[model samples]
Target: MFKPLWVRSLFIAFTALFLAAPLMAEDVNLSERAPSFWKAEGQDNTVWLFGSVHVLTEDHYPLADKVEEAFEQSAYLVVETDVVNVDPQAQQQLMINAGMLRDGQTLEDVLGEARWERARSLAADNGYDLEQMAMLRPWLIALVLSVTELERMGYTAAHGVETYFLERAEREQKSIVELETLQFQISLFSDMDRDTEVAFLMQTLEEIQDLEAQMEMLVAAWESGELDKLEETMLADFADYPEVYERVVTRRNHNWMNDLTRFLDEGQQDYFVAVGALHMVGEEGVINLLREAGYRVERQ
Candidate 1:
């Protein structure tokens, strides 16, 4: 099953949209480009929404003053999930339990001979051991292949937007919160039907060959807050794959709305909410959802 560059791009896009960032750049000039940050006013407090890159180069750092100020003022930092606090061992165990194939099945049995061979070749080219990787399901394989390629490109989660704030939140002892758990996030991929998972893996393999260039386009759109370019590059083509978009972006955004809006209504404290940049744009995005719900949301 073939997919477009944008569809394949989602495999990489999810890196930023979900797990983490983009193609590691040698230099990222943030002086002129507006940060993907916005503000929503509440009756007593405010909510700051910063579109985050899950993994990024060290050069992306020294966040914009607007973003920094929001964090400084807010009492709580909210992310999709608090991955930093998850125990490493437990994290590994969860992946194992969730991704492992059934006892009687092998990856070849699932992906079929030709497709399995293609996956094996892709894995080796990406420096993953096919034999060990063969034990997992398609979604898990796709996840591993994508992340490993990003790491090879020098983009890493340690330098991600959430990781940066998460560490500081721990040091300064600021309150940290999660919109979802790691388990729930993982389940999003794991629960896909078998055919969809196969297509996902296959397109992902095709996508990563030119992953760096594709991500550069995505990161540029994200960095400059060019909503049109972002929508075109990241979302427009999803008209053909609405189910994936609904599953990966829409439903999750709606689910997060309850928690996101509560910060405003509770009047307890301001929140600096950061999720993947994709969640902040489009008609169904969290920002618009906030606007539709009658809050004053402005780009910062």
Candidate 2:
């Protein structure tokens, strides 16, 4: 599931948002090249769509001038889910309600003996007590493992792309819009098929062994603004899992198309739409979907 550097990069960052605190941004020279930026030109107002890495290391800032310029010009900041504004207690409750198994079901029951032992060993190696996570669903456990592994490598949600933009937006008093509720995002994990969830957890555990290399490749691709490379690295790993890919990536993109179209149709206020970088790539992504609707979506 996390084969691509960016998808894995953001997924872990997304999980860490609940536990991490905001931090001040570092001062640095503007990057020569940053992640991809697109413009969805409308009859009147325009929407600037930027691909966001949910979690990042300190080195990811300061963003390229184009990103800052887009933020400066737009009236609103729209994201998949506005983590920065949500209450910590409410967010935690949302996760618990969606990610915990009911009745007598334990994580060990979901993972089985052999896989459960492997999970325990992995957690132990990383200095975590797996027993504390026995009540969490496999999807939640996968997130725990990912967040722990990413933290060990120095990535933090405090430095994520959305957090960066969100902080600046707050200082500037920009209006924020959420495409989906926090509960909606949590349900993506809660609704997973049991077998698929276990396989997803196992795959994440396998990928942890190569976390360093994966991070390197992903960070480089993101900073270089290589959209093709990003799509390949992110989507190739999930080709075999059509159901997961469809649900996690394709379906969400489909669902967002209408809301995105309304932004264009309204043409009343300009928008700076920042979402996970994964949503901007591939054929079924918002970029092509908008193009298919007869709007010019250009890389800016």
Candidate 3:
């Protein structure tokens, strides 16, 4: 279970981080400390790319000066999605609409006997009731359980990096754009293959007890800004779950590359593009794609 924990860590780091959290920040160094920041220069424009952790803690801010500088220099801020203006209640209803099962199917029916019992047992151990999760689709159940585990391990969506910046953008009246939509992000899970979704849920359950240790390593690796270590611990682990990797990371990276290049070529203003750190690393990442397209992308 823990053997593939790093792969799951990357999954959580990339997608779950984008899920909105409460806006919160605490005093921290003002020095340059963003995990990975890059400047992609086009013939007529520039876009600063910063790899963002979706959820973090109060202690992870005040971000590095360079990140702030880039934001100041840019005319627009881009995120995977703009969660800042979404209504929480509307979002909840949207989730309920997408996360429930049809034909009176239950989570147990979806997970089957062994995996259902495994999940129920884990729930009991963590003081949760699987009965409460009965109507959730498997992917939703996985997200619910994983988020609970992450919370137990001292992580909160409210402390995520994206929430922090979105608040700033609103306060400053800076333009904010999205690479995708909230509906599109939600569909990523809602549309997952049944077996792969179950495997993901099972993998998440198996890693519940180890999440703290895994995230500790993950945070450290992220903070160090070492692309190789980040790639190894995050992206490389996904090799075992090829379909999950392709759908969640690879495909999105490719799509975002097109959006990124277009922004460089067509946008009238410099932009600050923030996405999950995972999308900025490895061979298929946006960074490499831009570099291959002949843009001068350098770490800032």
lDDT of each: 0.75, 0.75, 0.74
Model 2 lDDT tens row, 139-229? 8877777777777777767778788888888999999988888787777777888887787777766766777666667666766777788
Q: Name the candidate, 2 or 3, with the larger lDDT value.
A: 2
Per-residue lDDT over 15-61 for candidate 3, one digit per residue giving the tens place of the 0 to 100 score: 64331122223343437465788998876888999887776667666
Give the clashing pairs for model 2.
none
| Candidate 3 TM-score, true structure as reference | 0.90
TM-score for each model: 0.90, 0.90, 0.90
Global lDDT of model 1: 0.75
lDDT (C-alpha) at residue 251 in model 3: 88
CA RMSD of all predictions: 3.3, 4.1, 3.9
Residue 294 error, candidate 2, Å: 0.4
The TM-score measured for candidate 2 stands at 0.90
Worst 10 residues of 1 by lDDT: 4-13
